[model samples]
Target: MHHQEIMSESIETTLALVDAEIVCFKFVVCGTVFH
Candidate 1:
């Protein structure tokens, strides 16, 4: 049970990082296009 909890936490963290990266990428793309 403890191992599973750790695994779940890591997965959530990874997803958050990925989401942040995607948002950053989109922002950069939009900025470049608009400028």
Candidate 2:
């Protein structure tokens, strides 16, 4: 994939993980971290 695609994928994965963490009550700071 191209460089932009790779970066996009990484951002998506990070957001997914942050969402999961928020859902699981693993952390309450994903908002600032992910954004």
Candidate 3:
């Protein structure tokens, strides 16, 4: 049970990181296009 919990937490952290990166990428793309 503890291992499963740890796995889930790690997954959530990774997903959050990915989401942040995607948002940052989109923002940069939009900025370049608009400018």
Candidate 4:
């Protein structure tokens, strides 16, 4: 139904945000270690 579609889109957006946060975290860790 339409509600389910909206739910899935929100879930996907949340997952994308988490993925970006993880990548940023890793980058910061690596930079700190190298520096």
Candidate 5:
């Protein structure tokens, strides 16, 4: 049970990082296109 909790937390963290990166990338692309 403890191992499962750790695994889930790791997955969530990884997903969050990926999501942040994607949002940053989109913002950069939009900024470039607009300018």
Candidate 6:
């Protein structure tokens, strides 16, 4: 249904944002440790 599609899209967006945030945080930590 249309509602299911919308829900999946929203979930996918949220997960992508979360993954990006985690990667950024990890890079920051590594930079600080190495620098």
Q: Tell me the tens digit of each residue's lDDT in model 5 across 1-35.
A: 99999999999999999999999999999999999
- For residues 1-35, what per-residue lDDT tens digits would candidate 1 score against the true structure? 99999999999999999999999999999999999
TM-score of 5: 0.89
Residue pairs in clash, model 4: none
Q: C-alpha displacement of 9 in model 3, angstroms? A: 0.1
Q: What lDDT is reached at residue 33 by model 6?
A: 100
Residue 11 CA error for candidate 5 (Å)?
A: 0.3
Error of 2 at 14 (Å): 0.1
Extract clashing residue pairs from model 3: none
Worst 10 residues of 5 by lDDT: 1-10
Q: Across residues 1-35, which tens digit of lDDT does each residue of candidate 6 receive?
A: 99999999999999999999999999999999999
Candidate 1 clashing pairs?
none
- Runs of candidate 6 with Cα error greater than 4 angstroms are none
Alpha carbon deviation, residue 28, candidate 3 (Å): 0.4
> TM-scores of the models, in the given order?
0.95, 0.67, 0.94, 0.93, 0.89, 0.88
lDDT, candidate 5, residue 16? Answer: 100
Q: Against the correct fold, how does model 4 do in TM-score? A: 0.93
Compared with the true structure, all predictions reach lDDT values of 1.00, 0.83, 1.00, 1.00, 1.00, 1.00
> How badly does each model clash, as a count of residue pairs?
0, 0, 0, 0, 0, 0
Residues 1-35 of candidate 3 have per-residue lDDT tens digits of 99999999999999999999999999999999999
Question: Whole-model lDDT, candidate 3?
Answer: 1.00
- What order do candidates take by TM-score, descending? 1, 3, 4, 5, 6, 2
**Cand. 4 Cα-lDDT:** 1.00
Higher-ranked by lDDT: 2 or 4: 4
Compared with the true structure, the alpha-carbon lDDT of candidate 5 equals 1.00
